[model samples]
Target: MRAVTYDSYASDNSRLKVGRVPDPKVGPGQVLIEVRAAGVNPVDWKVMTGGLDGMMDAMFPVIPGWDVAGVVRGRGPDTPDFVDGDEVMSYARKDVVGAGTFAQYVAVAADDVARKPASLDWNQAGGLPLVGMTAQRSLDRLEVGQGDVLLIHAASGGVGSLGVQIARDRGARVIGTASEENHEFLRGLGAEPVAYGDGLVERVRELAPDGVTAVADFVGGQLDTTLAVLAEGGRHVSVADNTVDQHGGHWIWVRPSGAKLAELAAMADRGALTVEVAGTYPLEKVGEAFDASRTGHTRGKLVITP
Candidate 1:
């Protein structure tokens, strides 16, 4: 099978290369997917640089992707939930950092794969799982609901964009932080956009004078701002900063869950959610895709079609 692989960590991402590798084996409770598209994320580059080495063991020549949209080519024993030719998407992060989704084929645990939303094309579906699930987990942990005012930092980025829509669907008033260029984009997603950086606290206050009832910090280094603008007794969570926990907010990590992805699919099908794709790259252009992701400015998801 043709796939991207990195022999070892490199701060410069110099090790990523495309080559033929052994096909992934289907084990019990797993399903082999014929890869159609894969999502490029900051973590993919981070993993290449050994950022997650402390948490996940790596095998040499690691395949570098987690989000996938594809067709089930086969299923392992005891996996009765899907059949051959089923269209699916998954946050396919294994406990070990190898055998990833940036390939012609990938074998994912059945519990981690979900049927793709009918409304999303391959690129959108491929980009949906990780960012979508991350946003869902953050909102769920914050208990965001009707009558709540939610502030999301970096709200125009992949996860933040999805977070805005999901929070709005739950009846929360969403205040999203983005650059001046993306303010209209955020507004279209049902959020009141506030430009980040200096005066962020004041801007948020102007929108919600009592301060926001919840803050979801998708961008790190906003702890002070998060603390300053949160309403009294409000909840907060951050995917980027663990220090948030020390300030009475939760630091969350998204766990792979097909059930949660299915819920997101339902939201998409019902018109309550939509994925924004900034661009798409072919499998051979994984390096360029990673370069774009590292820029920290794309307004939506970047996808790789294999």
Candidate 2:
């Protein structure tokens, strides 16, 4: 199988190469997928650069990706929930960094796989898992619900965009922070848009004068802004900053859950959720895909058509 692999960590992406590699082994309770598409995320590049090395173990010649959507080709022992030809998706982050989705085939634990949303095509499904799960986990931690006014930092980015939609579906009023260019895009996702950077607190306050009932920080370094606009008893969570925990807010690192992924699929099918694929690259051009993600300007997800 042809897959992307990196032998060492470096600031440059030169280490990422597409080449023939042995097929992944299907462990017990795992399913083998003939990958159709994979999502490129910031963590893909960050892992390659050793940003997460101290926290997560890595195997050499590492294949680096976690978001995948494809058809099940085989099943490991004791896996009875799916069979050949099932269309599925997974946020397949392993305990270690390897056996990733940026390949023609990937072996993912059955517990991490969920049926793909019938309403989404391959590209959208591939891009939805990681971002959807991260956003869902953040919202769940904050207990966003009806009567809440949620303030989302970087709400036009991949995870933030999904977070906005999910919060809206929960009957919350959303105020999303984005650049001036993305304010309208955030508005289209059912969020009141406020430009980020200086005076973000004031802008969000203007939108929710009584105070935001919850805050989801997708981009880091907004602890001050979160503290300023959050209601006295409101909840807050951040995926980007651990310091949030010290400030009485929860810090989230999303876990893979088939049940949660299924819920997101249901939302998608019901037209209450949608995923945007900003660009798609072939497997051979995965470095370019990574570069695009690193730009941090894409309005939505970047995908690799593997």
Candidate 3:
């Protein structure tokens, strides 16, 4: 199988190359997916540069990706939840950093793979899992729901955009932070968009004078703004900032769960959620996708069709 592999950590993405590698073997409780599309995320590049060295041990010549949408080509024993020919999606991160989704195929634990939403195309489904699951986990930690005014930092980015829609679906009034150019995009997702930076607190105050009841920070370095705009006794969570825990907020890490992905699939099927794919790349263009993601400015998801 041909896949993207990086032999070592680099200051840049110079080591990423496409080449033939052994096909992933299906282990017990695992399912092999014939890759159709894979989502490009910041963590892919970060991991390549050894950004997560302390948290996840990397196996060199690592395949770099986690979000996948594909057909189940085979299954291991005891995996009764899915069978051959099933269309599925998964956040395919294992305990180690290898055997990723940017390949002709990947084998994932059955507990982390979910049926793809019937309404989404391959690109959208591929882009959904990681960002969708991140948003869900953040909102769940904050307990966002009816009567809450939720403020999401970087709300136009991959995870933030999905967070906005999910919060709105739960009856929360969403106030999202983005630049002037992305404000309209955020509004389209049912959030009242506010410009981020210098006067972020004042801007959010103008929208919710008493401060928001919950805050989900997708962008790091927004702790000050989060602290400023949060209502008294409000909850907060951050995927980017670990210091959030020290400030009485949760520092969240998304876990793989087929069941949670299934819930997101149901939301997509019901028209309550949608994926915004800004662009698609072929398997060989994984480097380009990573370059775009590193810019931190794309309005929607970037996908790779293998």
Candidate 4:
């Protein structure tokens, strides 16, 4: 199998390399996927740059990706639910530093994956797992529901974009903040689009007279203003900078959840959810893919196809 790996840790994507790697073998209860597409996330770069070195599981020469969508080519004994030829997508648990769907073939634990939405192609499914699950868990943690209003920071971003659509589908009034360039797209996704910058709090308040019941801030690092927008007893979840404290709600780091992915996949299958792709690159160009993901300006997701 062809794969991309990093020899050193730096924020630089130049360090990534493409090479031939032996196919992975499934463990007693693992499944081997014929990877058609892989989702690129912010953490992919963090892993390459050794940003997660403090985590005891960090391993060098890692394959830095979690979101994977593809066909099931083989299954190991003890894994009974899925069969060969099944299409599945997932954000495989990161208990080990790097072992996921970035190559032509990947071995993932059976408990970590779910059937892909039949409505989405390999390209779209590739980008769904991580961001989609992040959005779902945030809303679930916050108890976001009908009749509530939501203010999403970076609503045009990966998780935020899906979160906005999900909240809208659940009958919640949604307001989103993005750059002026992405305002129209956000509005089309069923949110009142507001430009993010100075005086963002005032602008959101103007749009939501009663106040926003929840705030999911994907863009992190000192979000006092974002926390201020949350209504009393509202949920405040941060996918980035999880250590940051807040006034009212708890912080959350998106964990791998097959059940959540199942729910999200079902939504996509029903056309109640959609995956947007900003760009795609060959696995050999994983360096370039990661570069694009770090820009913080991708219209949606950056992906790598095998």
- Quick one: ranking by TM-score, best first? 1, 3, 2, 4
lDDT per model vs. reference? 0.95, 0.92, 0.94, 0.82
Ten contiguous residues minimizing lDDT sum, candidate 2: 196-205
What tens-digit string does per-residue lDDT give for candidate 2 at 207-245? 888888999999899999899898899899999999999
- As a whole number from 0 to 100, the lDDT of residue 188 in candidate 2 is 91
**Deviation (Å) of 43 in candidate 1:** 0.7
> Which wins on lDDT, candidate 2 or candidate 3?
3
- Candidate 4 vs. true structure, TM-score: 0.95
Candidate 1 per-residue lDDT, tens place, 199-270, comes to 999999998999999999997999999999999999999999999989999999999999999999999999
lDDT of 1 at 46: 91
* Per-residue alpha-carbon lDDT of candidate 4 for residues 1-306, written as tens digits (9 for 90 to 100): 778877678768776787877788888778888888888898888777777778737656677778899888898888897999998987875687766577888888888889988898888899999899889888888788998898888999999899998998889988888999999999889999998888888898888766778888777853676667766667677777565553555577778867778998888877788988998999778878777877888888888898
TM-score of 1: 0.99
Can you write out model 3's per-residue Cα lDDT over 1-306, one digit (the tens) per residue? 999999999868789899999999999999999999999989999999899999999998899999999999999889898989999999999899988999999999999999999999999999999999999999999999999999999999999999998999999999998999998888889999988878889999999999989999998999988888888999999999999999999999999999999999999999999999999998788889998998999987999998
Between candidates 1 and 2, name the one with more favorable TM-score: 1
**Cα TM-score of candidate 3:** 0.99
State residue 168's C-alpha deviation in candidate 4, in Å: 1.3
